[model samples]
Target chain A: MQDQLKLQRAALADFGLFAFRCDDVDELLHRATELVSEALDVPLVKVLEHWPDRGEMLIRAGVNWQPGVVGHETFGDDVRSPGGYALRCDEPVVSPDLDVENRFEMPEVLRRHGVRSMVNVVIAGEGPAYGVLEVDAQQPRGFTEDDVAFLRSYANLLAAAIERVRVHEELRRSAREQGILARELGHRVRNLLSLVRALASRTSAQGRTAEEFRTAFIDRLQALSTAESLVFESNRERTDPLVLAEEVLAPHRQEDAGSISIEGSSVDLSARQARMFGLALHELATNAAKYGALSVAGGKVSLGWDLEAQKGARKRLSMTWQESDGPEITPPQLKGFGTRLLEDVVARELNGEAKLAYRAQGLNYTLSFTVDG
Target chain B: MIDNKDGNLSGRRVLVVEDEHLIAMDVQDILEGWGCTVMGPVASAAAALELIEGDLPDAAVLDVNLNGGTSEPVAEALRNGKCPFLVMTAYNASHLFGALAGAPLLNKPVDETKLRQELSALLADTASDRCSGT
Candidate 1:
């Protein structure tokens, strides 16, 4: 008995080392079952993994079981099964003789294998119990306290190994995801810089003084910055178009609170869409404040949007910027940056069209775009 | 062989395929300033392909990634037409796969002078190839 205890102790130490080096949970579990069987001199030893959702303990790994037994067999998670009882009570359950034992019902797999005696101990981790490690013998025999203690120790080692591997895998996955996010952020910054360059170069300096140019460029940049902030703060793939419009027009709304009217149905827009839409709105508001309706008191600028259902789950958003009660309007003699940005740039970007009419009373601007419904 | 003259790009039709509206307009403005007749600043692959089918330009300038889709198909179509083109991207050429992997690559924000120089080289090459008629 003393020699057998020494052999079991030696097996436990060797397994501890093996578990320390092994990274794969499956290989460790299988190795654990084999080591337990060898140390106990039992014909069958199995590791049953607990599935709380299914309320079943699956035979995840085993030694000396029939070909179809391991990975295809399950034991009930209720107290009627020795593995379940041991797991529930967090203690070893020993059935010295199944022929005379009336406490627990024999599992079908054990009955098929002619297993007459068994010992079960819970394999517990730092978080929760992993499952039960069970050793079965064909002959009717008793399992001593020493055997139970050794088996418990072996189970503990296996649980620690499983947890370590799980944590390692999780860390690796997060690191990979972080790398992707960093690369994506870099790409976005580059695109933004390119966009700023485009804006600067395209903002014609033909007529405006240096001060005027600076103000116009800064205002446009501020509009873009506002759009970006809104897109990020929403923390979603799409942002509310109405909220975006209100936010972009917030600065100009202070002087003539009732003059600028913005009404729109709830709609979601992508980051790019919101940016382009916001820039166009900024241009319209700037133009209105300078030469159109918002330039004088009692002038009015009403912006309204309507959604029209289109074919194949698509929706068309039609927005009208109607200005009134200001100085009489006349078409510009030459096409400027503002006109090109509204009619050409914004339209092409949104895959839509923008029409501006310099009417006698006011400037009427209409924008129409298609979006996924 | 190859002419790097100022008026060489004049009357040449160049198609521009880019998803970003501002960038697209900027490219159009630059190419138009060079006296090249810009066919498009199309945003998507389908639109670019449609334009290609309707009429092939003298050459093309394509962005590698168009919105969510790659410009590989458009590059393939341009290749079949034997039209010379250059690629502009926010990424490295190694990141590009298939046909875009080997095409002339320019990173954004593209240098206006370099863009002109590269287009001149491509146009010069094509012009020389036509004269040789081999």
Candidate 2:
């Protein structure tokens, strides 16, 4: 009697340390299986959950069981197995002689897996049974009442640990979803503010005259807004220069009637360059429509670009906007806001150079810049 | 602002679908001044659908984008109803609504004279067709 008391005290102390040391669900289950098998001196210890929907017992964790049969084995719909009966009734079930108990029938599945005698303790959390913790032996080894009671206490602690881990995983998933939503909202707000800025700039440039300027300003702002929408839809960190050029030129493309040609290799530009380039293209297209190529019948505008490698391992992009076949060309006496915007403002903001050359036939503008790597 | 040169649509009903309140009101005024009975200035696709179901208009002026790029359903319904509608958009008309390939397009903020001219032409065509049927 004294030896049995000592054994019970030792088993209880081991189970207390094992439960406290577990950090997560998998760790807790692993340690519980090890502790139970070692304390009861049984060859196999398993924690099986009764899936009521499936009417099956699933071995969630196991120790010292058959090499491959631990998690893969399942006992279906049979209340005969010790685990199923213990989980259903929320009781500790012990079979001293499996051949004797009429209601306690041994499942052939468990018997084939070398489980002879077993004690199943129902693992309960707050209200009902969560699963079953079982200790099994290859031979007909009888379990004392003290062993069953100790296992029942440990089973409750394991169930609580499992619930804590599940809550932690849910919190992590919620945090990730919230982060994604916040990022998308910020991106949309930034794009809207940029649109407003472009509108203000275009309106300010069209002179102080109310009706005439408003008409021209709205036309230009609409063009910029279209380009901005395309950039946002692409979801690119840096806009592709070739794509920006195509979007700005789309409204002016006419098949075999009037030509607006583009020639260059594809290059990716930063957002600043993309926006400034879009503004410059809008200015060029407007000029073409009013006094240059596109204004006359059968007139054409050619836009071309090339990337030159610099000595310091940098690439300089050179672009030219040219117009042909229009009315007699003459330089304006005073520089308009369009000229100042294209020549000084856009060039300075983008860290580039712009030159406007008034040729005999049409207007020619060149822009050059070294982009960052 | 409504140029009723042919004077065909002096009593026909017209619907205006625009998200911007000022723009919608301007369009309504233009259509009403043309002697056409105007239905709405509805802001969203849902509201437009509700208005149409309540009283189907003879024609509509639709903004290609509202809330986002989701005005295609409204366009489809109008087409199914066999209503000759015009699209008013700030976007590049070809790029945004290319699928409605041969439909009439008017860019916004609309020019007053151009808006009057186009609306008159479209309404006159619709009125003549109805007269021929009768």
Candidate 3:
């Protein structure tokens, strides 16, 4: 009786530690299997659960079992079978001598695996029996009634822990999927808004009475929108100027099929600079279409750009817009809204300077700006 | 100067370069009511150019976008031939012709009265120029 009380206290203490511990499921299961094997001093200990569809007893965890024996072995749903009989009773069943117990009918497979005595505890719950936890030894009459009671209690704790860990793993997976979906949705929303803004700007510009300003402003807005979409879509901190320019100009290819002319070495621009340049190009294209070469049949617009190291130890980007074969143009008497928009609004907003020239043959516009490294 | 009250637009030939079929028909009806000959509600830039090459209209009302691209070529041809042309665009004038900054532009949905007044003025100028032989 004294030994029984000492064993009960030790089992309760181990149960308390298992209940409060918050380790991962695999680690927790491994520790539980080790503790049960040690506490019971059984040669083999295993936790098995019912496979409802297959109607069999399948091992979830095992200690001191031969390689591949735990996962591969199973007891089917025959009521006459030993495992099925234990599940039906919903109580611990000790077989002191399996060879003499005729009603027990232990399978030949179990005997081949060298099992002599066995204690099986049904994991009964609010619903149907879950399965059984079993301890096996080579010597007959090895398991007592006390061993059956101790194993049943241990099985209850393991079942609760498994359910808790399953819920935790599922929650983690759900949270990770939600985070990815949210980021993708945000990016798509931003792109759609940018597109709407570009459409609005173009519509407003095309309503201008002064044809020159109308063309210049519309083209510039289109270019800016294109570049803005590219940068936002890339999700990158920096972009190359040449690649950005190409994307902006792609939609405005000449009717004659002449490729857009590029004239500069590659320069890397910060995200802000790339957007600013996009807006500037839009303005240039609009102007070219209204009075420059783009306004005439078979006319060509040439884009030239170069980078200069300024005296202030800053790199300045210079771009020139030239048009040929367009209508004979005369200088405007007043600075129009487009001029103000590009030279004042855009330049001030982007920290750049612009020059506008209304030549007799076409229009020439230049923009110079510093870009951050 | 031609008086606004004058109903007749006899001997006047008008070119209509609009992409939308419904809008083109509306403009055609307006010109015909004024007793002018209406040439086309041309759908594409190529078609407009073809019509212009065949017969020069006394005046034209052009939409800035036709089919997929700009109607700048039609505008250019009219300017080269010294024919008076007005642009009709859904886009604002300041946005439509940035480089050739000072051309006459009309916004859509167009104000019929303004369009009539501008067309009358342009026709009157052309008639006077012909009389003066300049």
Candidate 4:
């Protein structure tokens, strides 16, 4: 008996240390079962959790079970089961003999396993209840009151460990989510910088002056910023292409006048597509403000799009920007940054075809892409 | 027939694996201006890997993160196949662990001139011995 008490103290001390060593709830629960078994010298000790909603007890954690992992279930919780009896009250239920014990039903889960005697203690009872702790024996045995008291203390420690793990799991989940969010923010910033660098490079290649490149690049960046903000505000992957065009042209439009006329219906574009398309609009609007229809009084620009019929029953969304009522258009000797962005980058990125015409009357830019919707 | 500043990158195929569209376009222009043939500015690492499986390029410029996925598999393939490649990333070197730690890394907002200079030297050295067989 002296040895038994000493072993119990050793087991209790080990369990306290074990709680701090686990990274997973499964490992923590398994260690609890292992410690319980070692303390009492039982081969089969388990944590049977009450599932009132499920109308049965579940084997949450177990040791030396012949089948299954932590998810396995237990038999009905009728009065025949000592776990059920312990769950009904706050105290421990001690069954010394199953041969003549008629107080409760011996489930097949226990009887088939050759279990003769068992002690079931309520794990926690401050509120609803955590579950029942079952320590079983294969041979007939009478459990002393001291044994019951010691088992209760063990159950209390197990309950506290479960709560600790629950809080730990919550903290881990929050940290993981924060990590993902930070990564996403980092990705967005990187993409923004790359885009800016590319824009500056291409703009400088064709820009006649430093001022021209700076002005054009910043406008394009603003358009990109607008598209990103709209997407972020909606908290969705798809943004309205019409809204994208309007937002890009908003700053360029003549104050309180009919300088820009829009004619397109709403259509969905992926965030990537929206940003590319939005940049194209910024280029067109900026060019119009510089030398196209928006440069003169009563000058006007028509920005419109429609679903057009394609070969083999496919549909294409065609967007057009026509400028009129400005000075007679003179084709530039070299294609500028706006032309390259519209004709090359936008076309390539959206899988569309772009055409820029320096017509006698004004400039007309058109793009046709397969409707994503 | 190669110089440090102006190597004959003409007609040499170089694969560009980048997810950002405009950056890829800039790379294409710079590579094309140097007279090199561009293989791809592929949007994802998986697609880039698929493209190189059938026919390897003379050299490769791989972005470390392809649409939020690591381009390590492509890097591993290039290494295993005795191919030379450059790694570009927005992430820091400390965050890069394991088999991927020690390779060359160029940060985002890449300096195009430096990239060209490095590539020219890399190609000039290997182009003499490497392209002769392929």
Best-fitting candidate, measured by lDDT? 1
Q: Write the per-residue lDDT of candidate 3 for residues A261-312, one digit (tens) a residue.
A: 7676576676556766776666566666665676667777777788888666
| Order by TM-score, highest first | 1, 4, 2, 3
Q: Could you tell me which residue pairs clash in candidate 4?
A: A80-A104, A80-A105
Task: Give lDDT tens digits, candidate 4, residues A101-188.
Answer: 7777888778778899999998884466778889889998898887788898888987887778778889989999999899878967
Q: State model 1's lDDT.
A: 0.87
lDDT, candidate 3, equals: 0.67
Ranking by lDDT: 1, 4, 2, 3
Model 1 iRMSD vs. native: 1.0
> Which candidate achieves the best DockQ against the true structure?
1
Superior by DockQ: candidate 1 or candidate 2: 1
* Candidate 1, position A103, lDDT: 69
Query: What is each predicted model's overall lDDT from 0 to 1?
Result: 0.87, 0.70, 0.67, 0.79
Q: Write the per-residue lDDT of candidate 3 for residues B1-134, one digit (tens) a residue.
A: 55423534666888898765435655766677777788786867788889888477878888776656777787787776777778766655655663224567776655667778777766776664432212
Model 4 chain A: lowest-lDDT 10 consecutive positions: A204-213
TM-score of chain B taken alone, every candidate: 0.90, 0.81, 0.84, 0.84
Off by over 4 Å in 3: A19-26, A124-129, A142-145, A205-373, B1-134
Compute the lDDT of residue A55 as modeled in candidate 2: 86
True contacts kept of 1: 0.84
DockQ per candidate, 2 decimals = 0.73, 0.01, 0.01, 0.53
**Which pairs in model 1 have colliding backbones?**
none
Cα-based TM-score, every candidate: 0.91, 0.45, 0.40, 0.78
Look at candidate 3 and tell me the lDDT of residue B53.
Answer: 85
Structural RMSD, model 1:
2.8
